[model samples]
Target chain A: MRLAALLMLMMAAAATPAAAHAFLERAVPPVGSELATPPGQIVLTFTEGVEPLFSTIEVRDAHGSVPTGKPRLPPDNARQLVIDLPSLPGGEYTVIWHATSVDTHRTEGSYRFTVH
Target chain B: MSDIEIAAAVLRSVHVAALASLFGTLLFMAVALPVGSGTAQVRRSMRRLVLISGLAGLIAGLAWLTVQSAAIAGADSVAMALHVVPTVALRTQFGHWMLLRLFLLVVALFLMRRPGVAIQIALAGVALAVQPLLGHAGAIGGAAGAQLIASEALHLLAAGAWLGGLLPLFLAVGCLSHEMAAATCRGFTPIGLASVLLLAGTAVMQIATLMGGLPGLFGTGYGHVALLKLGLFVVLLSLAVLNRLVLTDRLAATASTRPHMRVSIAAEMVLGALVVVAAAFLASRTPGTHEQPVWPFAWRLDLGVFSDTASWAEPTIALGATAIGLAIAVAGVIWHRIRWPALGMFAAIEIVAIPHLDVLFVAAYPTSFFTSPTEFAATAIAHGARLFAADCAVCHGVEARGDGPAARSLPLPPADLTANHFRAHNDGELYWFISHGFTAPDGETAMAGFSGVLSSEAIWHLIDYLRAHNAGIAMRRTGSWPQPLPMPQFDAQCSGGRIIDLDDLRGRAALIVAVSGDEQVEPRSFDNIGAAVVVVARGIAATPTGATCIASEPQVWTALAIVLGVSLDALAGTQVLVDQDGWMRAAWRPGDAEDWTDPNTLAARLRDIQSHPIAVNMTGAQVHHH
Candidate 1:
């Protein structure tokens, strides 16, 4: 019975959910979204806290890449990253992000959202 | 593997082997060998071995650090890595641990010649214990992490005591008198046995934590390496058993067997070295559970058979026959006179049982157990829906019910993808059918493969879309979902510069309104009834007034429409009530009578949901019948 309990404990520990690396959890202008008006900035949130110094967010359109400000973590949430965008005409835009978590595991993804 | 990774693994193996040998030799001299049993020559040789292993460990530890620095710096050459070594050593946790290990080794080396065996063993043991802190075990947190780390430390110590002591034992057998040699072998047996038991137990714990279970063990690179290590370990154990049971007795009785015993010991040492190398390789690879498993077999046992009463008869008969056959064989073995008759009866029983057991098997593929690379989120589902329209709608139909425009053209009707039978196939099996296409038993092509047209990520998105589409159909037909679907998450601008998403409303019931911006409903009224309200406007200009949180994105309409199994126009004025766990519990359409807009009706629904919170399977994967 003791051996059975220890085996149960080990199995339970193995089943515990632990995030191995940073993943794109959610975004303000969500992936594949379309808007009636262009937004002033882009915000990206990850499943784990990320280092803003090593992380980056790049926005581009059909013409070429657009200039954006440096990515910064919000004061309240370390997992939230915000980047300011200049006023622009409406078109489909792609947002690419690279995140390095505190443990130094890195992940990158890209998605497109349209502005009418 | 890259050049830097290979270098690191090699250095790590050398470092661990050297340190284990040093610690193990000291331990054997202090505890296992009888006091005053070693002669001058034996004592001098033992001292030399300790000094050499200590120096080798120090050098290997430094080289390991250099390779790690190169990998972290992304340096192309040794010189560049050397330049950044100082930075890594000072700035990183890995570097700090390595420095501490080196300090411990240095102190142990200084005390090597002194008559302080206990101090030397303690210092070396501490240095070796620091190893797991630099590997995958260090990255984990919480109670499980602590358990993993502790098991790993004990595992290392046990390995050191056993594998590390092999060389010293070989040395003693070669040099000692016949009586002395026999005595030394007797002395080592208890220590070796204890170490082996400890090693095996700790290893099981580590495998449970790192490999997950049998599927992970058979389906990943890290697991393959671990299997290789286990193979080596078994051989080492067999040799150890041979020495203890056969060779030790012969050596005790006759002087002639000493040479033979030395040869066997040498083989054990070689196998032990191979085990260490395999462990080093495993440490460099990702843990098995984190990767997608490519199942190698074509058949898998589905315990799901037991869950269906109709399917239980065959397996039950198979198990009963096998059990009876085994009992008869055991009785025959004890009786001896009826052995041949019992053997014949057992064989006949097994032949009858085997076919019945076939019902438990299911057809599987190389990708049969693969998980989705993309998350089961709303965005991926929406993206998948678009892909399905462009590629799959011709034969599968817009609703995937096997009644498409091209259904009459195929030799076999397309499969109904939204049926309950669809849930039987796992994600990887579906991925295989989609990428490789389906073929009828008569050799006709039922569907063409989409590998040439759709990228792998696009295929995953398509699968996510199918899952959501199936859930929507189930909900519409049954008036409740067979399983809860997570609310498709969306972010919206809220008051006070604070952003809110559907996730933020968790821990309370939420009423998500898909409005046309023309509704007279007051959003704050739902809040008074103890539910958070989120308004999803059809268009940016259609933003509803007096709403603190609004999702005005256009894609939000299309995504939620897919879940509601409705068109964009039909999506307006739809409301879904989500439980505290973020699962969509109930949905109301625009034309439904006695709708949730009434406060009392909404309150009653909220009370029902709160009283019976769902035990959600967060991954949203289909559970097997068993």
Candidate 2:
């Protein structure tokens, strides 16, 4: 009886859903997008909750870094980081983000978008 | 590994070994010593083992904390580690768990001075249980995570009971009389059996969860260490079987076999210690699934070959022959008369089967199992298309049809990138071919290597473009997409004042309408239809009302254009039907179809898509092989 119970428990543990590692699930101005006009902000939603203090979102163009506010969590959402942007001239831009999940696992990625 | 990593691994191994030995000794004394068989000498020996192991565990546990602190603090010496040890012990989760473990050990040791077996067992068990909470098991959250943690704890306890019990059993064998020794051995058999069963079950669960599969098992450092542990365990299991089945019975019959039994048990103790060391190294390394697997073999098996009737005969004969050979080998072990004949028959079968088995394998490279670092996104595809025009188009051509101006001058013509055979090669294989260059069978340089010319990320971008280009070509020819393409994800605000993501629309049908610059779309034209209507409008001053969701994100138009194999301007009137599985099933171009705009026509299309769900080739979507 004990062996059978143990077997069932093992099966249950094996069948459970996979745990998260905080990959970027979605992004504003979406990855590899080409835009005709500039957006007001950049929003990144990850697979797991991230620590705002350790996370950063940097936007840059051909000349230098584009001015943006510090990365902050949106209202009632710990998994998202929002950055407010200023009015910018038309050019190609790259968005680089570094995120440290609440569990302390860190991941970083960069993608490009054009403002024509 | 660095010196600090090596130090941490050694300290962890020592702590685990000491704890297992301590727990095993107490457990044996409580349950498996056999009634009235605990002689003064036997009892004294057991007590001494417990004290030594318990003290060793305490010291090792403390030392482990110091080493871990040093690694985490980036410290260079013992003095530097000592300075930060207190901070680590007080401030971190690892520190808290270690403190709890140390307290349990102290209590278990104190209780051992008395005769309270249940309390001692409970304390030691809890101490061991603390380990899983500090390792990979604790990283997960939720009810399933709790269950996984429990399984890990049980696995550790079972190891302690079996491997740790060996030393105490050895002491019992040496100090007790022949009958008592045999009885003690009998008592341990069931405990060992139960531990082995639990160990096997938990090990399988861990492998399935963490190993990623066969590619991981053969490719990563963690999997290599796990394989080493498995090898040691198999040897230990064989020794255990020999002891229980053959040696124990001999010891029961006569006094002469006691020395032999002692030697066997001592060997098992050493093997178990080695297994613990391998496990420690495994724990320190990243899980196989997280690492990029560099496939080590020259050839890889592809069972998909069996789908072809012409290719079935050789592999079938090889498999059948192998089964027969194994059966004969097992029979040879059971019967002495057939031993030589069985060996010869097996050898003959192997010689025939080995060559035929080649039909099941294909040539492989070091990067054959490597997953692309870049996702199959439009930006990547766009970037790759530019790179291909600059570097690859000279020979492969702008259309990748091997008809470039330079193609006629080359020794061999470049291969067509959009052929059906192109789908057979995985993203990794294509990445390798593109970066390292392809060589024809006749020794001609079919393509030049581009490693120095392009970055690794750039190569991945190029591969993404190739896939999208091929997909685009196939889609144009088929009217419907040849394979399912994931809808490019975007964030939007819905009409009901709710924020929604394109990914959130999965498990239901959605009609994505791309409107460019003041193109009047009847917001409720496709209303009352089963599918959700998502308007991806650009250059519009106001958000459209009555749509399920609306996004003015300009990039959404560009991304959708790439999928439809058209320009940004050409994307304005194109409407795509995405099925419940999140795959783009059918598309309606501007001038091609006005019928899909009707409510009845759109609803009928939704039903058709719902009934015939596309079989998405997940590998094309994302490479999952670590």
Candidate 3:
């Protein structure tokens, strides 16, 4: 119970205020990690709330796919941004993002992740 | 010598000679020769010489301009001449001044025979003043530039009064009657003395400014020529003094003195002409005052093709010879016998030793080669920006503020490209650093080498981009616009709730400002962009509310100028450009503002800002295709 509470407290603290610049805290399937199976969605947790209007998440493999739907923010966590992915075959993939924090500071980054 | 150099030298010498002749003839008429010399033939001949010299000077000036234009174009070919001549004439300060001089010369030519000769004299003075614009004085701008030009103008005028007058004075002595010749020679003594003093004072200033230090007086080719000119000038001055104090009375008292005095004056004229030629050569060579030597000269005891190490060959021998020569000269003088040869040998040894000292210093501490760009263009910076994005941005960060994502993973934090530590390095040192990647004190490579991946030209381009950014002239990739592209128009609010339309500021220069959320405008930003500044923000009140702040609706961002498809959000930390005619010129990421604070640079930018043409994109018109 204590460990659970500590983890919860840490997550809350990690969720930065909307006024601060939003930087990537962590990502689903991990950046530069080889996954045995493909993930259904890529979740990016930022240091602050990222505005959905100007922000983007693009994923490309050997070929390319038009990502569907706007990035969704969880009701419980505004700092966590979720982009749903379609089922994919095994290939090397690159994830590119343009993130605009609630305060309107924009930052972009790219990383490569693999799915076997 | 190379063909261009030889051509340039010849043209410069002829121009100087002709200019000197014209100036000297006029001065001789005014100062030395009285109104009535009872000899119409002598006066008519002098007048004819003046006319001839003026025409020759004009021709030589034109030829010098052509050669200078070709030299700047880096080719003597007819093909390049067509393009370069127009640019040099229309764009350069030197070109503007030269045209002004040519116009003045024409005016002077028309006014030459008239009683209003003062105007012609004034025009000639102005023409001489502009000559320094072709030399080092013009290369370095600002207060230093002004100082150099002033000193050089005075120096040239004094030289014209003295050296230019010598030939005409020589002729007067030969042709005039005994009484008139003595009177002319006596009358010139004071004028000559004043001009010599002026020349001495101005020469000191020119030498100090152009020769980095005393050491530079020996180290550079320019310095060697200058010393040679100085030595000749000393000899000329001695002859002038001899004539003024001793020979003047001889011309009045004895007929025998005429031949000796005339010969002496002729010698002075020749020496003076040589000095002018040396001055021309000095201007062609780059002064060592501001630049480091490319390579230290190595001396060998035994003359050979190359000497990597300093050898005790010539310098030691020269030193011994000079000491012995000086001793012999002193002994001969004591014995009431002057050894002219020994004195001459001493002077030669002293002059030779100057270069040897420079060689020793260079061989002792040689620096890496620095290849500075002869031209810095917007296109070069754009290419550099693209390369930087591909190669360096991943590590140095997008804005090169050194906050790239990979920066966290490095053992040592990547250097902040925008920091003073990097910008402070000379071009050669920077090149060396980039070619050979950084290493830690513990001998571990901090950054990977890009030498194998990129060519030298690419590396230089990267430096240009970084240098431009650091210089506050940000380079951007692309902004695709439709032909007759509608100007991205919007209203902005300042800090104090004042709304300004984009069209309202169109008639004059203005900086459409952009800053990140909560980012305050520093005092320097205001200092750098002294013109009107309009800040962009969303809604009624923005985070940075100030007197100059402008608030617009969030959807108004669609009307904002963009670069590389970067949205208004991404443009937050960048600088936006709205030219004078309401055209969206550029949206660039600015580097540090401090670099552009140089007065000379600011003055240049001010000129650019005033003259920069508005971008007019037409339908199917030229657009930046990234």
What fraction of the true interface does each of the listed models get right, in terms of native contacts kept? 0.07, 0.06, 0.00
CA lDDT, every model vs. true structure:
0.78, 0.78, 0.62
lDDT of 3 by residue, B1-626 (tens): 45776677778777877776777677777777766837566777777877887788889888877776666555558678655766666555556777787777777777767874556667766776677765656544446667777888888878887877877777788888867788888878766888899998877666666764333444566667787988999999999989988898888887778899999999998888888888887776656553443433332111221243456565556546656666877776676556676666667756664455333222211223344431233334556777888988888898787888788877678888766455545454556567777777787777876778888777766776666554331223323222112234344544433335554565655555554456665322332444455665532244334335453444333234222244556656454545565544544454644334343553445447658764443211112111
- Tell me the tens digit of each residue's lDDT in model 1 across B1-626: 88778888999999999999988888877766655645556767878888998999999999988987777666798899899788767765567788899999999999976887999999989888887777767655456667877988888888888888888888888888766777778888887899889888887777676775545666888779988998899899999999989998989899999999999999999999999889988887767767676777777666678879888888878878977998988888888899989988988997787678777678878877777766465567878998998889899998999888999999889989889878667788889999999887899999998878899889888887887788778877876667667777667766544567666777788878887756654545456556777777864443444445777666567778877777789888888888887878899986787677676887889878867887645531322211
Which residue pairs come into collision in candidate 1?
A: none
Docking class of 3: incorrect
Candidates, DockQ: 0.19, 0.14, 0.01
Writing each residue's lDDT as its tens digit, candidate 3 over A1-116 gives 32232233233321111112456756765566566567788878775555564578888888785465578778878677788888877889888888755432356787788888
Q: Which candidate model has the greater lDDT, 2 or 3? A: 2
In candidate 3, position B417 carries an lDDT of 76
Give stretches of model 3 more than 4 Å off. Answer: A1-116, B37-39, B79-87, B293-626
> Which is the better candidate, 1 or 3, if ranked by DockQ?
1
Docking class of 1: incorrect
Residue-by-residue lDDT tens digits, candidate 2, B447-528: 8888888998899888877776776677677766565567765667676445576557766788888877758866654445
TM-score between candidate 1 and the true structure: 0.84
Span of ten consecutive residues with least summed lDDT in model 2 chain B = B617-626
